[model samples]
Target: MGLFSILNYLRLKVIVTFIRLIAKWQRRRLRAAQPGPNKKQISIPSRDPGRFIEGYLYTPPETPGSPANKKKPILVNWHGSGFVVPSLGLHDVYCARVARDSGINVLDVDYRKGPEAPFPAAVHDTEDVLKWVAGQGDQFDISRVVVSGFSAGGNLALVAASVLRSSFEELKLQIPMAIAIYPVVDITVEPAQKVVPKPIRPIPAFLARIFNDSYTPNPESRKDPRVSPALADPSSFPGTVVIVTCEGDTLAPESNALAERLKDGKRKVVHKFLEDVGHGFDDFCREGSKAWEQREAAYGLIVHTINEEFGHSG
Candidate 1:
C-alpha cells in the first residue's frame, strides 16, 4: 500500500477504537437507567457458510386476547455508522422503542463495514438478511415486512429496495415500505462540498473522507447505484417510502432530491424535513432536552408510518 493509504488505515483504526469505547460506555449507561427493552441477541446464517449476521431482536409485548398463532409484522432496522463504525448494538434503545410503539418485531441488524469488507459486502449482507427474514414466515408476517435505517444504513435501505426489487417478488415477499432517516443518498459529491444551512452537527470532512475511502476505495465506484442510490432509477425503489431529513444536515439536500425523484404520483413518498436539527441530532440526546423531543417526534413518525402502511390504527 502507498504511504498515504497506510497512514489513513492507521488513522481509521485509532478512530474506530475510540468510538467503539465510547459506544460501549454509552450502552452501559443506557442499560443502567432501566431495562431499555426486552431484546435478545440473535444470529442468522449468512449466504456464506459459517458466516453470520448478528442483530438484536425486539419483540413487543403480546396484546391481551390476541391469537397465539398469529404472526406479527417485522421491521428490519439497520444502524447508522457511515459504513465504517461496526457498533452493532448502537441502536438498541431506538429499536426497542419502535418495537413497543409499533407493536411489531424490530431487528436491529449489523452488516460488514469498510476497511475490512468494503462495498457490496454490506449490500450482500443486507440481501441475505432479507432472505432470512423471508424464510421466517411462521414467525413473522413476511408480506408486511418493512426496512428502515439511519445514515449509511439509510442508504442501504433504498439500495436494497432498488437492487433486490425483483428477487423479493420471486420469493413472493412484500417489502411494503422503507424508511430512511438522514440517509446518505449521493456520494459523488465530496464531503467538504456538501451544503448545510444550519451546520449544527455536520459530519467532519476528515471523518467523512475516511469513511468514503474505506467504504468505496475506487473513485469510479462512487457513481455506482449501490454506493449512490440517488443515481439509481427511482422506479426500482419500493412503491412506498418515508424519507426523513434534518434541515441542518449536510445530507439533507441530496436526500431531499432523491425523495422528490421518487415521487411519481403513484408511489407513496413522504419526505419530512425536521427543522433546525443536524444529522443524527436525535442520537445521544439528554432526556427532556430539545434534541430528545425531536428524537421522540422522529420515532413517533416512524411508528405512525409503519402502522399506517400495515393497515393498523395507531
Candidate 2:
C-alpha cells in the first residue's frame, strides 16, 4: 500500500475499534433497558463463498384474525455505522418496536463494512439479502417488502430501492416503500460544509473524512448514484418514499432535496422534519427527555408510514 493509504488504513483501524467497543456496551445497555421483543438470529447465504449475511428477525405476535399459515410482510433494516463501524443490534429497539406495532416481520440485516469490504460490498449485500428474502415466500410476503434505514443505512435503503430495483423483478420482490431517517445522501460535499445552523452534535470532520475515504476511497466514486444516492434518478425509487430529517442535522438539506426530487406530483413522497434535533436523534436516550419524545415520534411516523403503504393497520 502507498503512504497515504497506509496511514488512512491505520487511523481507521483505531477509530473503528474504539467505536465498536462503545457500540457493544451501548447495545448491551439498550437490550437490558428495553428489550422490545424476542428475535431469532439468522444467517442468510451471501454470494461470496463461506460469507453469510447475519441478521435478527423479529416476528410480531400472532393476531386472532390472522391465519396461522399466512405470511407477513417484511421490513429489511440496515443500521447506521458511517459505512465503517459494524454497529450491529444498534437498531434493535427500533426493529422490535416496529414488529410489535406494525405486525410485520422485521429483519435487521448486518452487511460488510468499509476499509475492508468497501463501496459496493454493502450495496451487493443489500441486494443479496433482498433476494434471500424474496426466496422465502413461505415465511414472508415478498410482494409487500419494504426497505428502511438510518444515516448511512438510509442511503443504502434508497440505493436498494433504486439501483437494485431491477434485480428484484426476477426474484418477484418489490419494495413499495422506503423509510430513510437522517440519511447521508451526498458525500461529495465536505463534512464541514455539511454542518449548518449548528447541530446539537456535529459529526467530527476527521471521523467524517475517515468514513468517506474508507467506504469509497476514491473521491470520484463519491458522486456515483449508488454511493451518494442524491445524484440518482428519482423514478428509480419505490412507489412511496418516507424521509425523516432532523432540523439540526447537517444531512437534513440533502435528505429534503431527495424527498423533493422523488415528488413528481404523481409519486408519493413524505418528508417529516423533526425540529430542534440532530442526527441519530432516534437512538436510545433518557426517558421523558426532548430527544426521547422526538425518538418516539419518529418511530411512530415510521410505523404509520409502513402501515399506510401496506394498506392496512399493520
Candidate 3:
C-alpha cells in the first residue's frame, strides 16, 4: 500500500478500536429504550467470501380487510456512520418508527463499513441485499421499493440505485424513489466552498476531509460515481428522488446541486431545506424539537410517495 493508504489504515484501526469499547454499552441502552422491529436479525450470503450480510426486517402489523396486508411495500434503510463506524443498532428507533407509522416493511441493512471493507464493498453488499429482497416476491412487494440512507448511507443509497439501474436490467427492477437525508453526496468539495462563513457551517473542512480520506483513500477514486453519486449520470437515478438538506449544513450545497441535476434530467425531485438546523439533526435531535418536526415531515413525504406509487388509499 502507498503512504495515503497506510495513513488511512492506521486511522481506521484507531477509530474502530475506540468505537468498539463503547459500542456494546451503547447497543444495550439502545435496545432497552427502543422497541425492535418484527424480525430482528436475518443473515444473507454476500458475494464476499466468509462474509455474511446481516439485516433487520420490520414488517408492520397487518390490518384486517386491507389490500396492503397481502403485499407490503419494501423500504431498505442504511444507517450512517461516516464510513468508519458501524452504528446500525443506534438507528433502531428510527427504523421501527418508520415501519410502524408507514405500515410498510422496513429492512435496515448492516452493510460492511469502510477502512475495513472500503468503497465497492458497501455498494456491492447493498445491491446483494436488494437482489435478495427481489427474490422474495412472496414476502415483499418489490413493485414499490424505496431505498434510503443518511450521510454515508445516503451516498450508498444513490450508488445502490444507480447500480440496480445499470446492472439489473434482466431483473427489470426500478426503485420508485430514494430518500437521502443530509447526505454527503459530493466528496470533492472545492477549497473555496470549504470555508463557509460561520453560523451555517455544521461540518468543519478538516473533519470532512478526514471522512473522505478514511472512506476513499485514493483521491482519484473519490470522484468515482460509486463513491460520489453526485458525480453520477442523473438519468441513472430513480424516477422520484427526495433530498433533505439542512440550511446550516456544509453539505447542503452539493445536495442542492444534485436536486438541480435530477430536475435537469426531467426526474421528479423533492428538495427540502430545513432552516437553522445542522447536519444529523434528524438522528440526534430530541423528539418534538423543530429538527425532529422537520424530520417527521420528511418521513411523511417518503410515505406519501410510496402510497402514491402503490395506489394505497390508507
Order of all candidates by lDDT, from best down to worst? 2, 1, 3
* Predictions in order: lDDT: 0.83, 0.86, 0.75
The sequence of per-residue lDDT tens digits that candidate 3 reaches over residues 155-185 is 8888877645566545655587888888878
User: What are the runs in model 1 whose C-alpha is more than 4 Å off?
Assistant: 1-37
Model 2's alpha-carbon lDDT is 0.86
Error of 2 at 260 (Å): 1.4
The candidate 3 region of ten consecutive residues with least summed lDDT is 190-199
Tens digits of per-residue lDDT for model 2 on 143-211? Answer: 999899999999899999887887898888888888898998999999877776757786887788888
Q: What TM-score would each prediction reach against the true structure?
A: 0.91, 0.94, 0.88
Clashing pairs in 3: none
Q: What is candidate 3's CA lDDT for residue 142?
A: 71
RMSD of each: 2.4, 1.8, 2.8
lDDT of 1 by residue, 203-243 (tens): 88877887888788777999999889899888788878999
**TM-score of decoy 2:** 0.94
